[model samples]
Target: MNPLISNALKKDLELYFSEDDLSRNLYYTASLPHDLVDCKLKLKDDLLLAGLPYFVEAFRYLGDTSLDWDYFKKFEGKTYKKDEKAEIHFQLPFAIALTGERIALNLLQHASSIATYTSKFAARAKDKGIAILDTRKTTPGHRSLEKYAVRVGGGYNHRLGQTDLWMIKDNHKSFFGGVKEAVEFFRSMKGFYTPIEVEVHNMSELEEVLSLGIRHIMLDNFSPEEVKRAVKLKPVGVSFEVSGGIRLSNLDDYLIKGLDAISVGALTNGAPNVDISLKYNR
Candidate 1:
């Protein structure tokens, strides 16, 4: 596991095990059915496998480490069609395994959903070399895991936080008075040399931002023809990204020559959950 992810997973697991909270399985765990048992995981719907590492860690926390929990995860990040199954052999007190099932399954389902949605978009740009990026529009606490799932599906992650990049959005312009005014304040602040991206709502905004000599520009809600025109207007080495209201079916239409990337907000914000269930051996 990546050290960063391992560390973050540890912190997230702490929240699950919080003493001050009885939210997850704290109430049930108090009365464990003290006998060993085995279980398997089965899929009801098709999806890209994800969150196996997290799933493994979740069980690691619930079951005794000395016991045999020989879990073989060869399908994570790969597609699993309907009716597929993966067997896991773990010897844990019946209640210990049962109590942690919901939390563990919730994480796996959510991550698999995001990965599946991202894979559709990522596949569109694979041959073109154009990038597919996930927006910061993600579930509040699940951003890190959600973004990690995006990568699992072959998509690239955008800014992890506000500090990673400098972005000038329409609201930032409204708050700071105008596009140029916001740009000036951002420039005079004297911070790290982060990639500066400005969102352009129309041709005027696009031209205005272009005159500022910014390397990266986002064509927010622009039509395909308009994006084609904007692509022509951009100078050499300028990176152009189109965002807003793009769907998997129509994404290919937007990939014209010179277009650098497309940003999809739905990758994390609105992906549907993948259906999976845990089965215990009788």
Candidate 2:
């Protein structure tokens, strides 16, 4: 597993156990047998599968370490139709399966939803040679898994965190008085060299950043026409990305030819969870 995912899974499991109370399986402890049992996950809604690794890991973390997962491994990233049944199967102790079910289903449903939604935007952007990127607007404690789903759905990830990229947004520009001052300050820091992406709110700011030799730029909240005009002014070797207010409904309007990427926060923030359920095989 990726380190980011591993770390996230650890934190998520810790929280899950804490909130759900590890010692309480009420009915399972009261009367149900703790014997190993076969189980199948029912896909009640059509969705592109994602987070199987996280789902599997949840069980592993909960002490179902010897599970035979070859059956379900093949389904990751594959789309399944609604009411699909018997495709995903596994076995674990009844208590462990019941304990891990919610966490597993939550991860799978949420990640699959993001992945499914992202695929739509990614497909449209691919036609125009533009990459669909996910922003930092992700669920708390699920950034790694959510970003992973974005990739599974064929979209690219922007900065995972502040450290991944040096993005000078409008606030930074405002605080430093202008783009030039902000860029200079970042450039002057010794041993702090990293790829810098500056967000320009208008053509004037774009020109100022361009004049300073900054190649990576984000046209924050620019409309289709405005973006086209900015692209026309784009110099050779400069990459332009647009973010803010871009959505599936108006995605086509922003698929300008010269734009390199279109970052949408909704990919993670607005995606609804796909429905899924776990049923024991009696």
Candidate 3:
């Protein structure tokens, strides 16, 4: 289990239950045998599944959540029929059955939904070197987990956080007086090793970054034609990324424009939960 996830889940559970006395009441009634037990998960729609570990991890840590996963019953990046059942065997005290079930399914459905949406966009933009990138615009505490699903569904990730890489956006440029000064400041930092990405809205700024020889650039809010032109004008060896208002519907315009990658906020923010359910198989 990733330490980040372990820490986040611990924090989340602690935060949610700080004032609640329900944990004791809920645990007693939901406990199951700490020996082998059978449970199954079902989905109501076809989806690209991801984040199985987080689902399992959440349960394992949640007093009743860990179970012996039945590998043969799993979906391996394949589509599933609606109402299909997937099984796992685990031992838990019956006292916390409901608690474990709810947490596991919630994580599974939410993560899978993001993966489903990402897969759809990635498939549509296959080829043209146009990788689908998930932005840091993710659920605040669930960044790593959500980004993991994006990767599982054939998409790539942008910077993980402010510390992961240097992403100088328009606001930073304005706050620091101008783009040139920001570029020079970053360039001057001793022992700096991270790749720098600057966001530009127009051709003039793009030209300015080109002079700075920054290798990664974001073309924010550019029209399809402008993106194409920017792609042409990009300094040789520099990669171009597109963001702001990108959607599955208008993807083809940018896809055909031959941008290196497109980052969509919807991959995490507005993704609808893929319908899933739990059914007891007798």
Candidate 4:
């Protein structure tokens, strides 16, 4: 495990354990009926599968036992016919009815939903010279997990957070006079080690940042036409990203306008839980 994840998962596990310790096997010790063998997960509709590892991990964590995990997909990095089955094959190691089934599915369904949405968007952007990007508008404390699902769905991540990269947004724009002043202030701090990206809301600000030699520019809330114009006016080798209020309905329009990347907050914020069920398969 990455040190970051090692530290974080340990903390999360401790929290979960503490919260349920009062029950003292009230949930886990319930005797399950005979002949019930395995729980198999099935998708209600075709979906781009993701977060399989996390689903298994959550089950193992809750049950404090292991079960076989079986995965089946018709294709890799592609869509599937409707009504396909995605299963998690496993049997309880003991005849104990698990109490955390709902919680386990909650994580699986939500995470898979983000991945499915991301995969759909990424598929549309594919071969169009545009890359699908996810923003920081993720569930607090689940940023790493959500972003990991984005990658599994074929999308790229923008800066993980402020600590990972430098972004001069409108708030920063206010502290300094404008883009030029902000860029200058950061440049003057010569020892800093991060790429600086400035947000430009309109053409004038775009030109101002370009002339100041900022390597990256973000076009917030720009229409497709405006995005194209920004791309045309940007200096050679300057990277541009588009963000704000993007959705599946209008994503292609922006891609068609030739953007280098587009960040959709809805990937994590507005995700709809994918439908999955676990039932006895045998």
Candidate 5:
């Protein structure tokens, strides 16, 4: 498992199984007649696949140590159909399987859904060199996994967190009096390595930020005409990203030239859970 994934799952194990269940599950498994069991996972709907990392970790944490991580990883990043056996003929102790079932399914469905949705938008921008970006509006405690799924679906990540990229958003502008002040304050700070990307709503603010040598600007909620105007006025080498209300449905309308990226919060926030289920063979 990736170290980051391993660390995130550390909390998951504790969250999914209570201390009593954690202690008792071992005892429960010990009492079972069968030492090993067979299980398979079947998806009820077609979806782009993701989240095999969590599944392997779940089994590993629950006492199945013989898993070949590389071999099992083949199922991830691949699409599957309804009624497809995603995990076929895998054996683990029955108690362990029972304990990890829901967590594994949750991870798989949640990630695959985001991946599936991301692909929809990514495909819209395939030839344009436009990168599909996910916003910070991810579920708590699963940002890395969610972001990873976005990449799996052929989209790119914006930033891991606030620490990596300095974004002067609306609230920051409000707190610091205005966009100019916010940008000035960020520029005045020393040792900031990453370039600042400020949110601009109109032509004047976009022009001002451009003058400030801000290389990346997010055109929040701009219509296609406004986006075209901004692109025409934008400096060469500076990238413009669009956000707010941008979905796969309305995406083509905004694919103006010189538009570099689009950050969709719905990639993680509004994504539907893809249908995937696990059943142990009787």
Candidate 6:
């Protein structure tokens, strides 16, 4: 399993079981005639399936050691229509399935939702040779899973975490006196070769950073017309991205030529979970 997935799952399990008290389930454990049962994982809505690994891992983590791993692996990243009634059948201990259902579905639904939402933007961006990117505005502990879902939906990730790239945003520029100072400070550091990206809020800021020789730039909240102008000013090999106030509705307005990518925070933050559920097969 991916270490990030494992770590997040561990934290989720600890938080959930800590509050719910697993022993309560054990109260009826002895009365149940069967320890293991067949089950169906059903989709209640159309969705691009993601995080099957996490869902399966959740059951394994909860001691469902005999799960049908091969059966689940085939469905990852598959898109299913609501009317099709996508159903995944497997068998696991009844108590373990019940205990891990929500955790499993939570991770699955959240990831699938992000993937589904991102696909819309990605499909639109792809037509213009532009890439759709996801922002750092993800659930605190679920960054890894969320970013994974973004990729599954055809979107690229900007920076997995702060250290992945050196980004000088408005706040960083304000504290460091200006964009030049902030850019130079990082540039001056010995062996700090992480690619630098600066968020420029206006044309002036754009020109200043352009002179600083920053290769990657994000035009913060720039309109389509403004982005077209910024693109004209962009030197050869410099990449321009747009962020802020971007959504599916207004996405086309910003798909101007020369724009390298569009980063949408709503991919993870605003996406509603795709409906899914797990139930006994009876």
CA-only RMSD, every prediction: 2.8, 2.5, 3.4, 3.7, 2.4, 2.4
| TM-score per candidate | 0.89, 0.91, 0.85, 0.83, 0.91, 0.91
Which lDDT value does model 3 have at 212?
85
lDDT (Cα, tens digit) per residue for candidate 5, span 231-259 = 98878789999999988779999877899
Task: Give one digit per residue, the lDDT tens place, for model 6 in 1-282.
Answer: 555655666766566456566677676755544467888889989889998878888877876667665677789888899999989888877767777788888889999999999998998989899999999998877887899999999999999988788889988888999999999877776536789999999999999999988999999999888998999998999999999999999999998989999999999999877899888844
Q: How many clashes does the backbone of model 2 have?
A: 0
Report the Cα lDDT for candidate 4.
0.71
Candidate 1 lDDT, 1-282, residue by residue in tens: 344644668878767656425457556657667676767777777789888877767666664453332344565777877865644355556765676677788888889999998998888788887889999998877887888899999999888998687889999999999999988878876776877889999999989999998889999999999998888898998999999999887998987888888999999987878888887753
Q: In model 1, which residue pairs have backbone atoms overlapping below 3 Å?
A: none
- Candidate 5's C-alpha runs over 4 A off are 1-8, 16-34, 83-87
**Model 2 agreement with the true structure over 1-282: per-residue lDDT tens digits:** 444655657877787667777567666456755788888888877789998988888888877666545656688889888755535777888877887888888888899999999998998989899999999999888898899999999999997898677889878888998888888877766426578889999998898888989989999999899999999998889999999998899999999989999999999999977888888854
Give me the overall lDDT of model 1. 0.81
Instruction: Tell me the whole-model lDDT of each prediction, alpha carbons only.
Output: 0.81, 0.85, 0.74, 0.71, 0.83, 0.86
lDDT of 3 by residue, 162-186 (tens): 7666788888899889998887777
Clashes of 5: 0
Residue-level error in angstroms, candidate 2, position 247: 1.0
Could you give the candidate ranking by lDDT, starting with the highest? 6, 2, 5, 1, 3, 4
Reference-based lDDT, residue 198, model 3: 94
How many clashes (backbone atoms < 3 Å, residues ≥3 apart in a chain or on different chains) does model 1 have?
A: 0
Give residue 239's lDDT in candidate 3 (0 to 100): 88
Give candidate 3 misplaced runs (Cα > 4 Å).
1-37, 63-66, 69-76, 83-93
lDDT of 4 at 11: 53
Clashing pairs in 2: none
